[model samples]
Target: MQTGENEQALRKIIDFTRLLSIAILIIHFYLRCYHTFYKLKLTHEVVDHILLPLSKTTAFNTMLFAKLSALLLLVVSLMGSKGKRDEKIRAKTIVTYCVTGLLIYFFSSYLISWPWLYMGATSFGYLLFMTGGGLLFRMLKLRLGGDIFNKENETFPQEERLLENEYSINLPAKYQLKGKERDSWINIINPFRGTLIGGSPGAGKSYFIIRHIITQHIRKGFAMLIYDFKYDDLSRIAYNALRQYGGRSFYVINFEKIMHRSNPLEPETMLDITDAMEAARTVMLGLNREWIKKQGDFFVESPINFVTALIWFLKKYKAGKYCTLPHVIELSLVDYKELFAVLSSEPEIEVLINPFISAWRNEAYEQLEGQIASAKISLARLSSPQLYYVLSGNDFSLDINNPDEPKVVCLANNPQKSQVYGAVLSLYVNRINKLVNRKNQQKCSLIFDEFPTIYFNGIDNLIATARSNKVAVTLAVQDYSQLKKDYGREQAEVIMNIVGNIVCGQVTGDTAKQLSERFGKINQQKESVSINSSDTSVSRSTQLDYAIPGSKIAALSSGEFVGMVADDPGNKISLKTFHCEIQNDHDAIQQETAGYSEIPFPSAVTSSQVILNYQRIKEDVKILVDDIVDSL
Candidate 1:
């Protein structure tokens, strides 16, 4: 008797636990429905009245009605319970009850009396009921329908894991870059991918790049390398600001200074292969000192370093042995020690080393010589306070190691000089690449502004492979035409493809067509008309034909852009433009230019003025035509 009583007590406890679980699930379902309804504004009477009420019920009545129906289903389902067979029946019955309740509620709301309460509840309540029913049905289907839901499940495995470490970093919204969508400045994924800013010469491409550096990258403590080949007044201003931001340790290279170097062998004209080789050599040597110390005796230079391994290969080439950088790079991995020994033995290697050393030594001496020469020639000139103020007005000193404050390094000099803008860019990229590759740092962003002018040979390779090393590069270019003009069509395409993100601003003509094709197809329509008539008695018939054909490419506005992300290459996201506050660099330049005297000459008139003059001439032609017409 005692055993029987204990068994009965355990059975009651199990039954109560099951009842509590079911109650919790039901409550959760109702709360989800309520939340969804609130979000969609479906609980409001105003919307229901505007669309015409579907029923005479209140939102509370509709909710109560659903609950009562569900309770009835539960009671009826439990009353029929027998065993395991009854459990399956009960699950199916509950799903059916929920689904029927939703259908009945929607039909009465939309097709029947159109009450304000029913209309409001219909929007979100119907959605909730359907979702809950679907989930329950799926669970039942997985158990009883031979795992049909399991077979059809398409959820990604990785998505099930929590994203605890994926914190988002916010960017300031009021950047004044020009565009709507206040939320547009939020965390951007893969910003280093190529972004194209298109407009005419005065369309503010340089301005945007400078702002990005100062406000976004530098201000955030991330380093940036800019190559401004146009040598615009804006570049000079940016450089000055960078100098102030990053004290004396800040490295600023001017291409004009390289030309002024005492080395007679260094080419004074356009940058050729030799100049690139030299620049690469200098950077490699600088990097090698640290690499060697880190590796100690085990240090074997890879051909990618451009110093130890590449020098060895270049030496062989001088002695009638043919080789390329790629070949040396390939062999460097296989026989690093042998290559390092060969590199150390090369006599011709000294030719490259000597020039770099001489240039480095002469830099300070040249600065001293200029000071001495200026002092001797200008006792009176130096005494003039105004002259001193004008000549020595800007300070260019920066300390790079200050962690508390952000450092800004701006190349606001002539970019055309291969050594200054071009060399600095190359060195900066190489530095970051080495740091990431050797040390394995997971976060670093490199921004290359005005990219075309600083064309380096291996930039494409870097873009393609740098992601693996955690080095991200953002290349900002004016247009596709500019890229093609700078790097040729094939190379340009290769470089563009390597980048995973493409953001474009206003573009037209060939570029527009190209971008449109890349983003996806645009929908077009045409209209046609036909008419026919027949008479039984007179056998009269009539026919008519009309046709219209129209087609238009996708038109993107100034701040509007078509964003294509590589992760979802097929998806074309339309992003609102970034609004950036306009800086007064242009205004300052205008003021400075105004101070200079202008001379008038026949040849000095601009093309725009010449077009105006031609228009004036055309006015005479128009007068002649008017006289001829009058005479006729």
Candidate 2:
């Protein structure tokens, strides 16, 4: 009995609230109408001598009545006293009607005689009031209707919302335009999961990448690991100089220097490799537990772990003391058969360890030997023991160790050696992922300037999985055909599926087609016809047509391209061309080239030597031009 009484009381309260709201609305309507029409004497004046001298006054009256009827209908519709609140409030329709009424009222006033021009003036005033009132009411209804009714409400699914947020990093406003302000600029969205930026010899791909590194990455304090394959590329040296002279804090790992070190592969010397191995171990352990649960108790422990333990066991056995944490895991030919047998028994485990095992068996341990030896020599070579005191006294940290501080590391490498580039990129990405995952940070951006050339295995997995881990990767590539050529059909398809955002510039060929299909949906049209014969026979025909699937990549001007986010469906990718002005630094170029020398001859050489020879020519040209001016 108490519950029923409470329910009744609640119902009564709801009823009273609704009644009060309706009463307030009615009072407002009455006050607005009375103030606009009655007190103003608008209706009386309109019916009196408004259209007096015209023989078509009746027709004019009918038109005025019709327009006023529309205005009233719009007001009543907004009141929502009618049932079925799910109906959409047609604000556009209401505005159209109000505008039409205003037009009619103005034209009708022209029919009034000069003596009653006051009526015309009154009519004009009422027209303005009605039109303004209709527009204000319509706008309010449109804004508030969604809140009042469930039918009008809309929201994105949680996963899609998260994807949009994650993919928002590639959004042009975030990283594209920074430091240098411009009236206009071109933004190319790397649609490929990994993009490769390549062009004519002097197309400025590397220059663009370097500019981004210096301006965006370095300035912002994000860590970058550059593999300087090109011996001539000055980004690495420039970064070092910037740190020394400009007080820019950055970590530069000159892989060339590391490669040249006596024992560059040592765990202590190769910070990148050390971090990668540790990450590999963590991934292996996770996979091991998952495999154990899925395959049941019969599943054997991961052989990688067993091999690791066996290495420790062997180290302990040889050292004449218990194995410690520093005992490194190294495999040899003797363990090959056992490794293969274990891998065969557990194929899933093989997926995690195969690459590491391959690296170990092939070059990792030998590389470690070189690295370890090099560290000792480097320590020995330090002129000041105090500098060594800072280095040798503490454990070396990862390239991105200082999370609180921003550090930019440049991997300045040549693009000619595709495999080497791939290896370097894979190593850097693996290292960054480890650092980010370990720290469990809120956000980090991985910008790969030219992505596709460096084809790292499992990059697709990284794209799909990294978002949840707060790592956003942006890949800038030239075109789709380049990706298809390097990664082949299957891997490229896998890559495309993983990335949520796609920004494309002017493209041609298969890439353009693929992008068009992916970003632009198919539009279909249908036509139908029916005929009845004299003999009472009926016939019908129907036809359907479809626009060919293609990329929205039309031939754009130099800097134009289409861009799209995940949620937007139609015509969202449309964007004007962005023109980035290339800034000249003559003084810096001169200073950098001061000590640089040119090769004596480049008459006969391989394609790989072109970039090097080109640099030499540039230096020689500068010298020759200076000499000519001096002679003059």
Listed in order, each prediction's TM-score against the native is 0.37, 0.38
Strongest candidate by TM-score: 2
| lDDT of each residue in 467-492, candidate 2, tens digit only | 55544456666666666666666766
Worst 10 residues of 1 by lDDT: 154-163
**TM-score of candidate 2 relative to the true fold:** 0.38
Q: Write the per-residue lDDT of candidate 1 for residues 359-429, one digit (tens) a residue.
A: 33566555433322221221222122221121121232222223333233434345434432343344444
| Model 1, CA-based lDDT | 0.39
Report lDDT per candidate.
Answer: 0.39, 0.39
Which segments of model 2 are wrong by more than 4 Å? 1-210, 226-248, 255-396, 399-401, 404-406, 415-425, 438-443, 468-470, 485-488, 521-560, 565-632
**Model 2 scores what on Cα lDDT?**
0.39
